[model samples]
Target: MKATRLNLAPWLFLAPFLGIFCLFTVWPLLRSFILALQQTYGPGTTEWVGLHNFRYLLTDPLFWTAAANTGRFTLGSLFVQLPIALGLALLLNRPGLRGRGFFRLTFFAPSLVGLPFVAMLFAPILEKRTGLINATLHRLFPIWDPEFAWMQEYVMSSLILAALWMYAGFNMVYFLAALQNVSKDLIEAAEIDGANAWQRFRHVTLPEIAPIAGFVTLLSVIGSFQMFELSYILLNNTAGPENRGLTIMMYLYQSGFVVGDLGYASAIGWVLALTLMGIALFQRWAARRYEER
Candidate 1:
């Protein structure tokens, strides 16, 4: 009875979180999954159509296009943003890096400024003909095309750049936090053993931050899959010229809301959820392996 009492308090504390999780997250996911395997019935008239929606999703050309674009975005962000953020974090994590807090705050500020604001802020800057980037390039390098339509010619690059601007700072903050937690004793010990700066970081800093890095990687992957508000607000929901910036999430919205294909959209949603779950599991496994070593 006394041991039961001891553990009861923890469960009592957990009751709220568990209740909220089931109410908001778990329930919605189950409902969505069920919706995925069924037919599209408006609001209150869902009829049984087992695996039919999934079948259509698998065979649909639009589905393939959205899936491909999502993959490209995820891989592109992983390659371009992660390395740059990590490098910046490493530099800023130095013992006496000047204005560290100021830079950190400045970088992370954009992320906190809301997604809609980011789209509004960058839309004009990426305006095909008169955008600041092209104007500056025209002045500095006359070879650059001042007439380049960002919405058409450089659509993928424009979207990726916007994503980088919005997300790099957040990742930088994550890396910085993880870097700070690295044991100074380990670094000092490595230095005393005549290790070069590169050696110390490669051996100590990287390994210690593996779990955090894994977490950020998973988040980045999931985020890439779920990207919507930015593209919708900025590109006017078209993705761009030839749908270059069209992500899967946007496609889901376009299908459900624009095309009125709720059943198909639910199918797409389930696929996305499965993909995110797989990536998360892989990251968890990788984190465990890194920690074990």
Candidate 2:
């Protein structure tokens, strides 16, 4: 009985977490999948619709638009955010850097602010007439139009900028942590072998942090796909002019709550999940191929 109790102790301690995970995450996922196959007519009224929801999804132009916007945002995140974050991490990782701690805090503080807070803060800044952005641009380039509506005309670009401001530092923290784990001896050896700064980074430091880099890339992809709050709040819960800022999550929310099409929303949710899974799997496979090479 004592041996049995000892074996069960670990599970007993894990029970709370496991229970909450199932209740919140696993169960909702399963429920969504089920609902995706049905036609929801209210809270309690639902009829089995088989795969019609998915069939509709295949031809939905709005869905495609959302997918394209999401893809653009994800690509922008990879190209923009990762490079900046990694650069900052590398810069701050240099030996004897002054005020490293302060720099890290400064970069990371934006990420600590919630999405709603960020939206609220940037709203007035991006406004057409009295906004800071337009006013500054007008001062810097007097030829430029001072009445430019950034939030509407350049919706995706604006959203990307906001996302980068919030997440670049977060990724920097990851890269910094990864950089710390790189062996100093290896870097020194590379230096002694006449490898220049860029060469050293390309071979020694990069290989050491490849795994963490991959992880950060994965996280950025996921975060881009899950982008809703910032765009929603910033765009005033609308999809912006021509639905340019309509992410898959925003579309799903509109379908689920705004339009009262829970079944269709669940189907959209499944598609998003599947898309994320596919991209993640492909990324892993590519990383494996790179490692093998």
Candidate 3:
């Protein structure tokens, strides 16, 4: 009886969490899967479609466009944003740096600002003639074009830049923490072995921080794939000229809410979920392989 009661106690404590998870997470997930397999006219009407939605998604040009744009943004985040984040973290991690706290705060402050606020903040700054960017460029270089249409013409570039500003510092915090935990003894040993700065980082520091780096990379990729709000607000709630800024999430939003096609939206959502899961599994496998090496 005591053993049974002990077991029951743990379950009793976990009852609230389990109930909430089943109600919110599990039910929603199951419903979405069911919705993906049906054709819905509205919230009330659904027709069994089997695999039709998935088949249609394959031939959907707009879906492909969104996928391509999302891929590009993901690549940009991985290569560009992450490196900049690591560099900033490295710079800030240095000992005897003057005003380290102030610099850290200054860099990280942008990330604290919400996406809508960031969008509004960058709107004018990215504008053409009188905007801060083009105005400064035109002032510095007489030949530079002040009338460049960033939002309309260079949509993805603008989004990437905006993301860089907002997220670089946030990612830096992770790298900074990882850097702080790196072994000073190993670093000093490398130095004493006549290893240069780059060599020391490569041999000792990098290996120590590689796990954190991988985690951060996974987070960045996931975030980039899920990007919507900044692009939506920046492009004025449109997909930008020629659908240049159209992302997978944005497409899902348009389908589910705007176009009133909940079924199709569920299909897209499942695809995204599966893709993220695959990427996560791949990252885990790669990390294990790297650790083995």
Q: How many residue pairs clash in each candidate?
A: 0, 0, 0
In candidate 2, how many clashes are counted?
0
List the candidates ranked by lDDT, beginning with the highest. 3, 2, 1
Cα displacement (angstroms), candidate 1, residue 230, comes to 1.6
Report the candidate with higher TM-score, 1 versus 3: 3
True-vs-predicted CA distance for residue 237, candidate 3, Å? 1.1
Candidate 3 per-residue lDDT over residues 48-69, each given as its tens digit: 9999999999999999999999
* Per-residue alpha-carbon lDDT of candidate 1 for residues 1-293, written as tens digits (9 for 90 to 100): 99999899998999999999999999987888777766654555676788888887889887787788778878878999999889889888988778988988888877887777888899889885589888888989999988888867666566678889888999999999999999999999999999998998899888889888888988898888897877778887576767777788989998777777677788888888888888888888877776787
Show where candidate 1 strays beyond 4 Å: 1-26
Which candidate model has the greater TM-score, 2 or 3? Answer: 3
Error of 2 at 16 (Å): 2.9
Best by TM-score: 3
Better of 2 and 3 by lDDT: 3
What's model 1's overall lDDT? 0.83
| Reference-based TM-score of each model | 0.89, 0.94, 0.96
Cα lDDT, model 3, residue 84: 98
